[model samples]
Target: MKRLLLFPVVCLLLQFSYAQSRDEAAVTQAVENLRKAMVDGDKAALEKVSDDKLSYGHSNGNLEDKATFVGNIVSGKSDFVKIDLSGQTITIVGNTAIVRHVLDAETNDGGKPGTVHLRVLLVWAKEGGQWKLLARQAVKEPVK
Candidate 1:
C-alpha cells in the first residue's frame, strides 16, 4: 500500500517537472520575440507579446505603459540600433516567470544616439495560454 501511494506521488512530481521545463522554454522564446520585435519595430508582434498592463521602466527613471512603449519604438522615437543580451537567466514560478539579463544596446531615441549597458529584469506571465511581458525594469550598470 505504501509503495503504491509513493508511485503516484513520484509520477505527479515528474509530470510537474516536465511542465515546468516546457513553460520555461516558452518564456525564453517570448523574451527573444520581444527583442526581435523591438529591433524590427513590429508593433503587431509587440502588442501580441506584451500584457495590456505592462510597466516598462527605463534606466533613466522613466516609465511607460504598453501602448506608449510600442508606439515610441515603432515610431522611430525610441529606436534600438542593436541589442545584445548576456548572462541571461530565467526562473519560472507557477504561472509567472522572472528573467534577468545584462543588456548592451545602441539606441537612437529622438534623434540622439547613445550606447547603454544595463542590467535588466523582466517579468512574464502566462495569460490566455500565451506568455506575455508584464513588467520590466532596467538599471544602469557601473562602468568597468
Candidate 2:
C-alpha cells in the first residue's frame, strides 16, 4: 500500500522535473534567437523575440525602450558584427526566467568599429506560450 502511494508521488515529481527542464530549454533557445537577431539585424526577429515593453540598458547607463532598441539595430545605428556568449545560466521561477552571461562582441555602431566585453543580465517572461525578452542590462566586465 505504501509502495503504491510512493509510486504516484514519484511520478508526479518526475513530471514536474520534466516540465521545468522543458521551460529552461525554451528560455535558452529564446536567448539564442535574440543573439542571432541582433547580429543579423533582423528587425522582425528582434520584434518577435522581445516584449513590447522591453527595457534595454547599456553598460554606459543608457536605456532604451523596445522601439528604440529595435530601430537602432535594424537601422545599423547600433550594429553587432559578431557576438559571443559564455558562462550562461538560466533560472526559471513560475512564468519568469532570469538569465546571466558574459557577452563579448564586435560592433560597428554608426560606422565606427568597436568591441565590447560585458556581463549581461536578461529577464524573460512566458507570454502567449512563447518566451519573450522582458528586460536586459549590461555592466562592463572587470579587466583580467
Best by lDDT: 2
Question: Candidate 1's error at 93, in angstroms?
Answer: 1.5
Q: How many residue pairs clash in model 1?
A: 0
User: For every model shown, what is its TM-score relative to the native structure?
Assistant: 0.94, 0.97
Q: Which stretches of candidate 2 lie over 4 Å from their true place?
A: none
Q: Each candidate: RMSD to true structure?
A: 1.2, 0.8
lDDT of each: 0.95, 0.97
Question: Model 2 misses residue 28 by how many Å?
Answer: 0.9
In angstroms, give how far residue 50 of model 1 lies from its true place: 0.7
Task: Give one digit per residue, the lDDT tens place, for model 2 in 1-144.
Answer: 999999999999999999999999999999999999999999999999999999999999999999999999999999999999999999999999999999999999999999999999999999988999999999999878
TM-score, predicted candidate 2 vs. hidden true structure: 0.97
Tell me the deviation in Å of residue 122 in model 2. 0.3
* Candidate 2, number of clashes: 0
